[model samples]
Target: MSVSLPSALIGPLLVFVLLDGFIQGSVVSLLPVIRDTLHTGTGPAMWITATQFLSAAVSVPVFGRLGDLHGHRRILRVALGTVTVGCLLCALAPTLGVFLAGRVLLGPLSATLPLSVGLVRDRLDTAASRRGVSLLVAALILGATAGTATAGPLASVAGGGRTVLWCLAVLAAVGLVLALTPRISETVRLASGRMDWTGAVLLGLGLTLLLGSAAQGAAHGWHSPPVLAGLLLAPVALGLWVRSSLRSSEPLVDVRAMAGRAIAPAFACGFAAGVVVLGGQGVTVAFLDAVPEEAGYGFGLPQWQIGLWIAVPALISFLTAGASAAVGRRLGYRAMLTAGFLLMAAGFGVEIVGYAVMATWYAGHLLAGVGIGLAVSGLPTVITEGSPRDRAASATAVYYNLKTAGGSIAGAAAAALFSGLLTRSTHQPSLAAYLLLWGACGVLALVSAALIRLTPRT
Candidate 1:
């Protein structure tokens, strides 16, 4: 039960996790620039980021299945190669549609994080693997921060954001090269069968439908035909897939295992965790920019400062992740999750009731970050520990997919909450909308904490 990981194990995990985070964060940071360069409207422009979200949700489970069927290293190579080619396409694309096609190729990176988690579990001793997982989580968050903080400046230096794609391509290339280097060893028994292609298709289509609707629901009226079709069919398709999986001798995911008390709460929290982390981030930042100086709610910070300020919490979150493993071990994973969510609730609560001074804002964010770091670090460990060693990738992928879905739903909720709020001439949300966002985050965090409590003590 030694909780120390060797550099050999930690290095590859960080590389893949960081790549995933960097790609996601950088692509998002580039949307406005892409829109300006392509001369596209917000609706068309959204595909830049939305495509990643949709693809990630669907592809994660498939990658997980692939890992269970094949070796994780094999799948990891494919995923890294996919990202490399995708970034290259993005860099070379002459048109918006072509760029989007390139984005579709990069979707496999979504699966890389969970796959890395499984890789670590396969290679390390139990306690060391747990610590490795924490490092992976930290790299995921920290790399996102690096992407957000650096991409803009890098774009400026390179004369456009397209060069950032080139850099990403390079990173992906390095990763592909590393995948050839034999370091991370596979230890788990591989699940045998033809890959569950039918289940994969169903799951992919269902997620695409649900997330596509959510992404577009803000712009298209909720009652729009496209949105309505997705809303209705998503569940039907998913339900059929579930029924099929239960009957199939070999399923992509073990739906039955998901019902066990030990695993159930982790899945539940997975969804909430995504909503709070991604959605809470959106809400917190939007509030910072939206609160007018005259309104005494904000200090009228510049965009760079605003991003930096927002990172205060994220930075704290990143640092907390490294220590989260040991902390969770001492505190118990359940207690850690409970406290984390409670802290997040407190963070949002401050936003809801307190003044918008700089100190108050940072304090709230820092507290929330601590909570997020603790909960996120704990959830997957629970999943890995509870799942059969052979199905670790599938289990981790399932949790990760729910997290992506939660993020999509939360984004839509934020849009719905702030819809139609035009601040005078500016296109920002009104103060009231920001307040609502904060309150919503607080409530969701509280709910997440309650879910952790529902976990059995076994």
Candidate 2:
């Protein structure tokens, strides 16, 4: 069956994704400024970022499943509304604790995209759905690019970061308005059974413990009492979650299906993409912002310059993501996926060897951007199409959560590397820290490529 893109539906969905992406990108660039404004140290400031991802790891699946049980459009509106409150809270937060709480509420921001995917699947034919999904992902990257590119300039124009935070709140409110409009169509409520709250609570608790332990381990030594307690208890919580899910009639996630051939490899790719891409983000920004004389290695760029450098890769990914579906069809999904990871590996390899040269470093980022764009766009499509139609949102959530989990692990690992390789005289992270991080990311990309090759073609 032939289908056309429905402007009424696509327009609002695009706005939601764009708003989410913009919030994500702008927050990263604004973190240092926010930390200073709140008079918090680096350790606590890091929690602001960590909280968003941690909460998202739990919220995505819960929201996705809710979208399946109810209607996607309805759930999409709820997610958008929830995030608006989060943005407002962050904008006006008087203390670090309040800001972190706001970030937790913002967790549902990640769910908007997956909910939109369900809508697309419900409303469009397979071909149209692929195009729709590609467009939404592209918008997300594009929005991130815009946010990164503009955040610094906007902050400067407004004279502080609070103004920028207000701007994000306003954008989220606008997205909510759009989602609530009558134009956006609701998806069919195909799934049955009530939400598995017990499973959700177990899963959320498990992830919170796991991520919290990693963060604390980085701050305190791994053997520290709190860290040790968290690390030991995390597994028990997760195992219980798994067992409970297996017994439930309608679990929050299909744990067994996630391990099946069709979905498992895609999940692996998602995790690797997180490790190779999101894992390196903070390091890249820090390297660009570092004063060479003080750090003994870096460009010593200002905030806006740093944002611009990061935005270029995001911009490239926007283009590549928009085109990924067409390219996947021509190259075959397996070939495209394998090639994408290889390109990311090549990109990181270039950075590892030629980091001293600005031109070469940029080229590396551009290549990685293309690879990430392709890989991320393809993985969701693979997962959704492979899943039972009624459970598509949950499957996508699993992929997303795995990706976030990988990033969390990588972030902790990078912190360890920096701590271990600090330059004594400068008291800053040494060049060895960067080299090791980049090299590890490159190797992970290469491994992902190999795993993709072994998976059956999509």
Candidate 3:
């Protein structure tokens, strides 16, 4: 477990992870161009991203469990190959259906991080594992920032969105090649039976229905038939899955492990982070772009300028996350986590109070970025460390899935808030809505800090 790996051994994983983040970020910026090129309506075009999230919701845990059963390296390589093919299909697809198939293939991209974490934890010593996980998190954040910042420019230079997709495909292929190389070591595999297919299917089905419902409800109304049906059936599937898992000797995911002190609290942190940070991103951009005169309060910035504002905080986050492990080492992870949440609360408080001031807003974002970096990077380590050695990836997967669920829930709530509190003339969310959201986020952050503080040390 303490063995040192050659950079070559781990390099491929970093590339795969960074590329995954890049693709996720870049696609959002290029949605407009992609839509026009494919001649798709707004609703269908949006599925390009939604499909991936749905896919990830299912794939993350499945892949994690598979990696635990087989080897992390084996599963990671398979995932890379799948995503590579997905990229190629997307690049060349002539129709929306084909593109979505490709996107479905691309879902495994999100699993790369957890897989890599498991691999490093299995191969590296404790200190090294902590550092490695932190680095991967930083790489992800960095890649996303770079991708989002450059996607528009890259498309302009390349002449078409397809060209950008092609470039992404090529990068994915390179990562796959690296994964195929013999130099990379395989992780320690489980000593037990085959993966529990029934549990996987039930869990996947349940999560898909639940996430799909949230997504559809956010887009269309919550009362839509599909959403209603999904809401009604998701619980049944999930309940059955839970019952089966408890009964099985070797469930796909050991549900019992989830109740442990370290994992449960870490998961709570991830969920809170998703709700307070990840979920509000769209509204943040909207806030930046809203016309001040019409909306009564907004910066009235152009899209490019809004990206810059976002980039500043992201850059800070990248730096902070990269250093978070070392800080945790010095300060103790519990204390670090507590501080992280406090910083986020302070950030949200600043943003809420100084809504009209640009400098104050930027400072608030920076504070929140630092907090997010610490929490995001540290939470995974906590989960992995506390997990059964063989189940590290599975534990991380649960944390991720829960985080995504939180984001979906928050997104739905935000949409409802904006719609219900629309400014009469502009038909935009009232400034009061943003204030209320931030206030809620701030309160939640404070609550999370207390919870982390109260959580029993592993």
The per-model lDDT (C-alpha) reads 0.83, 0.86, 0.86
For candidate 2, write residues 242-273 as lDDT tens digits. 99999998999988888888778888989988
Off by over 4 Å in 2: 1-4, 291-296
Candidate 3, poorest ten consecutive residues by summed lDDT: 1-10
- Model 1 has a clash total of 0
**Predicted structure with the largest TM-score when compared to the true one:** 3
lDDT of 3 by residue, 1-458 (tens): 23344586567767877887898888888898889878899999988988998999889998998998899999999999999999999999999999999999999999999898888888878887888888889989999998998988889888879899998899889989888888778886562667888998999999999988887886888888989999999999999999999999888888887766667778888899889776655578988888888888888999889989899889888898888878888887888889999999999899888889988976887898899889888889988898888888888888888888888788878888888898788787899999999888889999989888766553
lDDT of the structure predicted as candidate 3: 0.86
Weakest lDDT window of 10 consecutive positions for candidate 1: 290-299
Regions more than 4 Å wrong, model 3 = 1-6, 189-191
TM-score of each: 0.96, 0.95, 0.97
Residue 216, candidate 1: Cα error in Å is 0.6
Q: Quote model 2's TM-score.
A: 0.95
User: Quick one: ranking by lDDT, best first?
Assistant: 2, 3, 1
**Candidate 1 or 3, higher TM-score?**
3
**Which pairs in model 2 have colliding backbones?**
none
For model 1, what is the C-alpha lDDT against the true structure?
A: 0.83
Q: In the order shown, what is each candidate's alpha-carbon RMSD?
A: 1.9, 2.0, 1.9
